[model samples]
Target: MTPPEPLRDVIARHGLQASKALGQNFILDRQLLARIAAIPGEIAGDTIYEVGPGPGGLTRALLDRGARVVAVERDPRFLPALAELGAEYPGMLEVIHADAMRIDEPALAGRGARVVSNLPYNVGTALLLRWLTADWPPWWQSLTLMFQKEVADRIVAPPGGGKFGRLSVLAQWRSHPSVAMQLSRSAFVPPPKVASSVVHIVPGNAPKDVAARSIEQVTEAAFGQRRKMLRSSLKSVPAALAALEPLGIDPQRRAETLAVADFVALARELG
Candidate 1:
């Protein structure tokens, strides 16, 4: 395998191509990858999970920064190139051949592992949902992830914002989410049409007032008809509103108007 080069040259040398089907876009920015690795504390002694690390560009950066990276790559075509990375890092890189969607991450990560990846555009939101919706907090201690700019906006959306919706509700319900960096199309080898942004989330224990899964269900139903008033929109979730009866929730309020605590109360009421 050829040694990596300036991000663009590396792509040209190996006949490397981005697969639209896989939602692959190669980042040429070394500093950005390093920044991601650094976000969840020092890399050393930390288990870092990177999904779809095509060509191991980010893998190299993670390893160089001293993090133990468990890289799950779905594309076998990139295996040879990734094998070279494993060779270089030796015990530091563990490359798995599996669809990230199907893999059992909790078992793989054990404890103290963090999910940090550039993320495959096609499956990014789905994967984020899985991590955020896990039963216990700290399933992955934190998430340093990339998403299309639109998704990023949703992740960091504040109450009453147009971009705020289900993603904002779910993500903010457990983790303190923020946009760490904004990336341009030119950063990737095959420039994507839209800009991208990196989101960093550090999950904490949900307040004792609510259960995690319950809030999830309530938010799903409430935001499902996000534009409608809660009284009208949440009518489908009689159980949720009934649960909130003691809390004196105004049935007419919409999902966006409700805070995370309110959703938790509604979720509990529904349960």
Candidate 2:
């Protein structure tokens, strides 16, 4: 059965507009929802972790695809609607009312599960960072998420690019990421200011000698100032030189100039 569109009209009638602070942009297109769900390689029979299933739009889409959805919604305003969805998809939609950022995600994706969502533009970067550098690799397996086009560029950026920053380092260090789909502003019920795209990331084992922690530390320092070179930027840490020494990365080089692997190496040397 096609999911309910009438609920959206009802939601708007009640003045339940998308919250900019929460980065809530509801997806009304059925085909788009299906595409987002399909991001985690072979989602069939795989459990899905969905953040912010506002009015159960994406929730219904995931359920229709036979994937069990663990939706974490923060807004109580939509709980009643979600509850109704739970009834419709028995033993499938597990709705939790909480802030997705604060909630422990790996704990949520028990067994063979995947991260799938039209991510809130506001918290998208934070959530992506948390999941990408997770301690365990097969924890969620893959992430299919939406972000502002700019954020998407940062995630998939390479060395010496403007989008390259701590985010670029962190995301590329752990996963192979790519933009799967782009949606225009017109796609939403009440359009947002910026365009958005779905980013699909497959988290696999890191390359040899890349400690996730070190990459994090180095990237933080490098992108902290963002204007200064590595040597100048890392002045906060007394042992910064020791960390950057072994990697053969120049102290004069800017953070954005370094590739993901270089950042990983520098991070390891930090200790």
Candidate 3:
């Protein structure tokens, strides 16, 4: 097989630089990118969806792992570099020049694919939330995504920690989320201001009786007033308030103290 051209050479050849406005921080380290690629293990035939594939660093890694990649990139500047990579591995890469947030992800990559990306910092959390709220046993088989460490902590945070809140509840309710790897700030080309980590999420069976929307409502109200007791914070959502009594949960408890299952039970009662 032909070797893919050097990524740095491709970038320089295309006169490309990471765009700060787009939250772009290109990961120039091939070994580190390979590690990110390995998170979706044994994915040879899987259609991997990658967002913001700046200069195709991780993209090449994914292709090297034998994944057929659908990479959605907003930055047109990196297209030529990506195209060069595509040529190296014929029919292995599909580069979409569009904003990931605006695209129909499931329609683009189809169902049961793994989503793996070094996501743009600005849209990372929002994108994760979007995927999380998708239909039970969501379209994607798994999410192996990079985010700022703080956000990664929030996603995998357990109850009682300061990082545990709405994101924690939602993420844990219908998925198994864990930190796959931590990356230093120096890993990127221009380097992001903060350290980053990869969070691997595999969808689990969602509570059949509860609406995902209801869970969002419950957590939003509960965490929106996190300092207040559940009785006070939940007053805004009568369903959640009503749930506490039936579930034998103390109304005086704060949001941070509730388990993910507790939130799911409350959401079940909300319907």
The global C-alpha lDDT for each of the candidates, from Candidate 1 onward, is: 0.82, 0.78, 0.90
lDDT against true structure, model 2: 0.78
1 or 2, greater by TM-score: 1
Which candidate gets the maximum TM-score versus the true structure?
3
Off by over 4 Å in 3: 1-3
Q: What TM value does model 2 have?
A: 0.90
Output the lDDT of residue 203, model 1.
Answer: 83
Q: What would the TM-scores of all predictions be?
A: 0.93, 0.90, 0.97
lDDT of 2 by residue, 1-271 (tens): 6646665674765557788788787877777776766666556577899888887777777888888889999988888888878998788888899999898776776955788887777788888877777775657767888898888988888888788888887777767889998989988866998898888888756776666776777678779988898889887654655667666777888888877777766666555
151-255: candidate 3 lDDT, tens digit per residue: 999999999979999999889998999999998998888888899999999988877898989999999999999999999999889977987978989999999
lDDT of 1: 0.82
Q: List the residue pairs that clash in candidate 3.
A: none
Off by over 4 Å in 1: 1-4, 243-245
